[model samples]
Target chain A: MKRNGITIGLIILLIGTAVTAAGIGAMHISPQQVIAILLKQINIHIPVTYDEGMANVLWQIRLPRVIAAILIGSGLAVAGAAMQGLFRNPMADPTLIGISFGASFFAVLTIVVLSSLPFMNGALIPKYYLLNVTTFAGACFTSFVVFRLSKTGGRSLITTLLLSGLAINALCRALTDLVTYVANDEQLRSATYWTMGSLGGVTWSSVWALLPFILVPIILLPRLAKSLNVFALGEQEAAYLGVKVKRLKAVIVVLTTLLVGASVAIAGVIGFVGLIVPHMLRSITGSDHRSLLPNCALLGATLLTMADVVSRTIIAPAELPIGIVTAVIGTPIFVVLLVKQKKQLRLMS
Target chain B: MIITAQNISYSVGQKPILHNLSFAMHPGEVTVVLGPNGAGKSTLLRILSGEQAPSSGTILLNDKSIQTFSLTQLARCRAVLSQQYMLNLPFCCEEIVMMGRYPHFNNHPAAIDRDIVQQCMQEMQVAQFTGRLYQTLSGGEQQRVQMARVLAQLREANAGDVTGKLLLLDEPTASLDCLHQQACLQKARDLAQHGYTVAVILHDLNLAAQFADKIILLKNGQLVKEGSMREVLQPDCIADAYEMEVEVWQHPDYNFPVLVPAEHKVRSILKTSNKNNIHEYNSRSFVKG
Candidate 1:
């Protein structure tokens, strides 16, 4: 009963927080006006004209950014949660498998090299499509390489996986730098901003493009909650409980790659959403993936939306990257969590 | 019903771990696999649990090939507890134990699942810790919780008909203290008595002697001896397997074998008066013979 109450409370809190965040951006729309604007846009007979400037701000500028933040945040957070479960390490994040570095490297390659290709420069091909495809392909390839290199006799050792991730991340970063060094000024600046991460480039088209990769995994991953619970016990125990440990690991890795790859392609390499959101929710939800996954998703959405709101308003007209705002906000909270966890451990001892 | 392994062989890297190992476990009896460290106890358990495939030969479950069964079907027949389990996230005790309902919860757990989990916790004396974080528990308490988790798995597997439930415990008591160790072994014995097939890998010969209805002794990954506890736990066989000198005597109260190191007993006796020491030593030697 208490657990049910907490779940319900968290849901309410998340909805309330998202709504408030959506209302409080730089234009300073009232909550009533925000609701009125939404209702009018939805064809409800409201007194509001959906004020042209506010409508464009809400729908074109803020709404897509909000949705992108929510999707990318939830994707990264749940990916981190599942990765932590799969690797059985608290510190494990989606990037532990090198997906982010791979995505960055490929995104740089596309922006610097592929866009310049003579045939590709033709009017026939869309720029974003080519970039997204290349980035996703590269991310998948690097993750697969990391996965294969970490396997020993058909089983993955956690230590080997961590080391392999570090190695692959370094290699990908080096290649990415090499690409950046040779690029022209404009390409270098774009590559640099992409690495730092922003939702400023998010469009309705980008959201639509990422929908399948992002939503499919989100919908499917929760189905594996029970299996992930069993997995938390250790691989041998999970297998004995009739879990196909190797198969489950493979599916999780692939799905995580998909989610992270999509997020990176859309928002660039947003750092702390994946690492911080899951850890925060784990403390509240008590680590059953059934509960943890959903809560992490909602909390992640709420957090990123709020971060986007701050990034947009904190400096008035000049916007800071959403990624910088998230890190600035997330680091202190992360340190607090770490210290609290240590204290909790001491108390338990 | 009988589960048989025929000429099973496994290797890790270049070194052979299990070589032509063969054994059978029968229902209505506790079959304990006894061996020292690196004797392939865990490897054998993994094979038996269907977690790992043996390099050669086959395991027949009730005269049917184990490979023929789906993972869920195999899970319905057997549950395993291994020595180490770590969670990157802290799980509440009830949540951790409730995971055992995974195989049975094709969709989601019902009230029956909660009841079974609660019952298992009660049985394992872990009910008090149900709301506590699993990581917060002491080593022994954690082991008991794991035992509860397995018991919940067994309960879920046997929810409808209660047949073919095999509990495979690999070094379940290694990290447990004396009280919890006895509790674990007794629980295994009780489960077997209630008609489940129980196979346990035990490191302590005395615990094996106390609870094992039958013992299979392995050395260098091969079955060295197999029989009733009395037949397999003989001092000579144990010494050969462990490379240690030991004496086994019947317990004064239970009549089960009690093992004592020969050197320690000798040291205690030699500290006594010189005159009576010879007499005591001779009498001890007589007892050994």
Candidate 2:
């Protein structure tokens, strides 16, 4: 019952934060105006403009960016939560499975090499398509490699995964650097910025395209919360409790890859959200995944949306990258968690 | 109900672990498996828990083949606590115990599930640790918490049918001190008395003798002897299984077997004698005796 109350409060906070974020851009719209605009678009009676400038700002620009933040945040956070559970390591992030390296490598390649191709130079391929396709492919490939390398004697070990992620990440980074060395000045700048991550370029089409990839896992993975809680007990206990260990790992890995891969494809490489959000939620929720996961998803969305709002408003007219805002906010929060955990450990001892 | 394994064989790579092993665990009995470290005690528990398949064997649980039962159905019948469980998580004691309800909680845990967890915690004397983090507890406390978790699993199974409760514990008391060890074994014995089939892998022969109704002694992955505690826990059999000289004596007050190293008395005498010659003779006698 308390959990229900918390969930309801979080929902209200998320809605309020998202609406405020949508209103605080260069347009200087009010919160009421933002709601009226949304309601009128949905066919509810409201006094709001469907004017081209306002419509473009609300629907084409701010709306997609807000939705992108929510989706990417929720996706990364859920992926992080699942990865932590899968690895049974609190420090594990979404990239522990090699998704970030994969996405960054592909994004760099598209920016440096593929975009320089004659047919892909300017006219034919949409900039978003080029970025999304390359990033998705890169993420998929690296995930496959990492997953395969971690399996030894037909079983996966947590150590193997950590080591493999390190090896694959290094390899991807090296390759990306190799591409960067030969790239033109324009390509280098774009590649560097893309690697840092941004939600500014998000469009309605990109949001729609990435929806299923993120939404399916968001819907399916939470149902496995009970199993994951059992899994956190250790592999043998999970198997003894009737969980199919290999199958569960596979499902979680594939789903994490899909969600994170699509998230990276749309929003570039947003780091730390996945790692920090879930860890924060686990402390409050008390390690029950059923509660922890949904809470992480909501909190992640809230954090990212708030981060996006800050990214837009902090510098006013000139936007900060969403990734920078997350890092700036997430680092201190992570340190606080570590210190709190240490203090709690001392108390327990 | 009886769990029967026919010619069960297990191998890791090319080396055999359990060679044509056969055993039956009957309901309402405390069955203790005694062995040295590499004698496949944990492997046998794993096989019985369905965590691993025997290389060649058919295991029957109450006339139904083990493979025929769905994973959930098998889990409903059995709960296994392995020798080593290190979770990289700082789960609270109650949450860790609640994991035992996973098989039974296809949806959210019902009122009955929570009650069983609470009852098990009370029985194992871990109720006070419910809100404490599991890793922060002492080794003995952690073992008791794990026992509570296993008891919760058994109770959950019992809720559906009292007859299907089977508890498999591997070295459940290894981390425990003498007092808690006795409590854990007594709990297992109590579960057996309630008509549940309880199989425990124990290194302490004395504890096994005190708790087990039937004891199976294993040597080199083979069943060397199986019978009632008195029949199987002879000094010779235990010495052979452990590859160490041991003296088994009947406890005057408890009517259970107690084991002491055969050389303990001799070693004590040599320490007090202050004579090198006597010490050498006693060392020789200790091995030869």
Q: Mind giving the per-residue lDDT tens digits that candidate 2 earns over A1-349?
A: 8777877887888899889888778786778878888887678867655455775688778898888888888899998998888877776675655678778888888777776777776543266666666776787788778768877875457678878889987887788788888998988877766667788777788787778878899999998888888888777888878888889988887788777778877776788898888887766667778887888889889999998888878898888888888888878877887797678668656
User: Candidate 2 on B1-289: residue-level lDDT in tens?
Assistant: 5889889999999999998888899988999999888999888888887778899997888878888877788777789988777676668999888888878877788888899889999999999997888878887888888888888876843344668777999999888988888888888887887789999999877788789899888878898888898888765677678877665555345567566776767546434443354324423322222
Q: When superposed on Cα atoms, how far off is each prediction in RMSD?
A: 4.2, 5.1
C-alpha local distance difference test of each model: 0.80, 0.80
Residue B276's C-alpha lDDT in candidate 1? 46
Candidate 1 residue-wise lDDT, B147-258, digit = tens: 8988888784334565777889988998898988998899999888777889999888889989999998888898889899988876578778988756666634465767
- How many residue pairs clash per model? 0, 0
| lDDT, residue B158, candidate 2 | 39
Clashing pairs in 1: none
Q: Which residue runs of candidate 1 sit more than 4 Å off their true CA positions?
A: A1-26, A95-97, A118-126, A145-167, A339-349, B156-161, B251-253, B267-289
| Docking category of candidate 2 | medium
In model 2, how large is the Cα lDDT of residue A42?
75
Q: Candidate 2: what lDDT?
A: 0.80
Error of 1 at B49 (Å): 1.4
- The collision pairs in model 2 are none
Weakest ten-residue segment in model 2 chain A by summed lDDT: A122-131
